[model samples]
Target: MRSTSLLVLVGSGLLLLAGCAPATGDASAGTGEAAAAAALAEGEASAAAPSPEPTAGDAEQWCADADVSARVDAALASDTEGPHNGVLVSPEEMAELGEPEAAIADQRRAWEALTDDEVAFQQCLRVRQGQSPVDPVPGSGS
Candidate 1:
C-alpha cells in the first residue's frame, strides 16, 4: 500500500513536471524526459538501498530521549494484559480500533515486523534510520 502511494506520488510528480515542462524546446531539450528519468533513478536507488544497520549509539540515543523514555515507561505501566501490550498490535486490530485499514496497513508496512522480538529490533533500527516516533497505544486500563 505504501509502495502504491509512493508510486502514485512519484507518478503525479512526473506528470506535473511533464505538464509544466516548457513547450518551447528551449536550450534544455528533452527536459521532461530527463526529469522523469532522474526521478525514476532516484526512486530505484532508494528502493534498492538496504536498511542501515543500527549502532549502539542509536540504541543509547533512543533510550536517552526523555520524551521517548517517558512514553515507553507510561505505556509499559499502563498495558498489562493484551497480546500486543500497547506496542505490537496487529494492523487489523488497529483498524478495529478506528484507524483506517489502508492507513494502518501502510503503517504496518513501514513497521516491517510481526513478532515481539522483531518489533523491538525494528523499533531500534527505525530510530536509527529515521528517528521515527515510537507509537505507544494507550491500554484499556484493565
Candidate 2:
C-alpha cells in the first residue's frame, strides 16, 4: 500500500514537471489575472500592511505570468521531491508552451481535483508561501 501510494505521488509529480507541447498563441493568450497576482506579490513586500488580500481562487489572475509560474513552482517544490522540484521551465520553453496562461488552465483543473487532505496540505503550503493564516481546518487542531 505504501509503495502504491508513493508511486501515485511520484507519477503525479512527474506530470506536473512535464512540459506541454508548444502551441501558437499570444504570450498573454488567456491570462487575465494580473490584479490578483499583484495583490499576492505585494503581500510579500507589504507584509506590514496587507491592503488587498489575494483570494485563494485564481492565483493566476492575481499575478503576472512569471509570478504565477513561480508560485506554482514553489508549491510544487515544497510538496514534491527530486532535484528538479521547484525548477520552472525556461522562458524559451514557456514561450513554446504558449505563454504562462497555458499552465494556469491546467493547474486550475488539477486544483479542483484535490482531495480534502490535499487541500489542507496546500493551505499549510500557502502559509509557508507567505500567505496569511486562515482559520484552522475543522477537526485539525492547530
Candidate 3:
C-alpha cells in the first residue's frame, strides 16, 4: 500500500511538470502569425483612411489677386450686418460663384482661386447662414 501511494504521487508530479513545460517552437510561430495578421489589418486601416485636405498658408497668393479679392471682399462685406457676419461662404455658393457664367462672376473667380484652407474658412462662414452640412462652429480655441 505504501509503495502504490508513492508511485501515484510520482506519476502525478511528472504529469504536472509535463503540462507546465515551456511552449515549443510552433507556439512562437503561431504568435508570429497572429502578429503578422494584426499588422496587416493595421496597414489596411491606414490605407483606407482619407488624406487630409489642403490648408491656407498663402492668403495673399490666392486672395490677394485683385480680381479674386474683389469678389471675396464683396461676399464677406455683403453679410457684414447680418447674423452671417464673420462667417465665410458656403461650398454650394462657392461652387456657384466659382462658375464663370454665374451672376456673381467676381465672387466665383475669387472662390476658385482660394486655397483649401480658405475654402474651409468660406464653408465656416456659410455655416453661420445655416447652410452648413455639419454642426455649427465649435468654440473658439482662445
Candidate 4:
C-alpha cells in the first residue's frame, strides 16, 4: 500500500512537470500573434494622434530668458565678492537662475545674501560671461 502511494505521488509530480513544459509551435504562434496585435494597437493609437509643433516663442523662452540671464549674472557676481572668490558655480546655481521669472528676483536676492562655495561661484561667473543675451525681436518674421 505504501509503495503504491509513493508511485502515485511520483506520477502526479511528473504530470505537473509535463504540464509546465514549454509549448511547441502552435502555442508560440498564438503568443506571437497576441504580441503583434498589442504592437499594432499601440502603433494605431500613436498614428491617430498628431504631435504638437513647437513655436518660435517656445524656443526663445527655453534659451535662457532675460530674467534667467540676469539672475545667473547676479549669483556669479555675489560669488566673486565673497569668501568663495575664484570658485565655480554648480549646475544647481544655473538652474536656480533659470527658474521662472516670478521667482528669479527672490532667488537672486537669496543667493546674493549667502556665501557660496568657491567652485560654484567661479562656475556661475564663467557661465554668465559665456552666455549671450537674447536678440531683440524682429518687427515681424520679415
Predicted structure with the largest lDDT when compared to the true one:
1
Q: What is candidate 1's lDDT per residue for 54-77, written digit by digit as tens?
A: 456666755465555554444334
Clashes of each: 0, 5, 5, 10
lDDT per residue, candidate 2, 1-142, as tens digits?
0100010112332122211211122111112233543333233233433313335552433233454455445644453333233222222222333335655344444555656545444443333233432333323443
lDDT for position 35 in model 3: 53
The local lDDT score (0 to 100) that residue 13 gets in candidate 2 is 27
Write out the backbone clash pairs for model 4.
87-118, 87-119, 87-122, 88-118, 88-119, 88-120, 88-122, 88-123, 89-120, 89-123
Q: Ten residues in a row with the worst lDDT in model 4?
A: 1-10
| Candidate number of the best TM-score | 2
Q: Write the per-residue lDDT of candidate 3 for residues 6-117, one digit (tens) a residue.
A: 0001211110000111112111111122353334323423443322332342343334455545544554455223222233332233233232234234433444665755
Q: Each prediction's TM-score against the native?
A: 0.25, 0.28, 0.24, 0.17
Sorted by lDDT (best first), the order is: 1, 2, 3, 4
For candidate 4, the per-residue lDDT at 28 reads: 14
Candidate 2 vs candidate 3: the lDDT winner is 2
TM-score of model number 4: 0.17
- Deviating ranges (above 4 Å) for candidate 1: 1-58, 61-113, 137-142
lDDT agreement with native, every candidate: 0.35, 0.33, 0.30, 0.28
| Candidates by TM-score, descending order | 2, 1, 3, 4
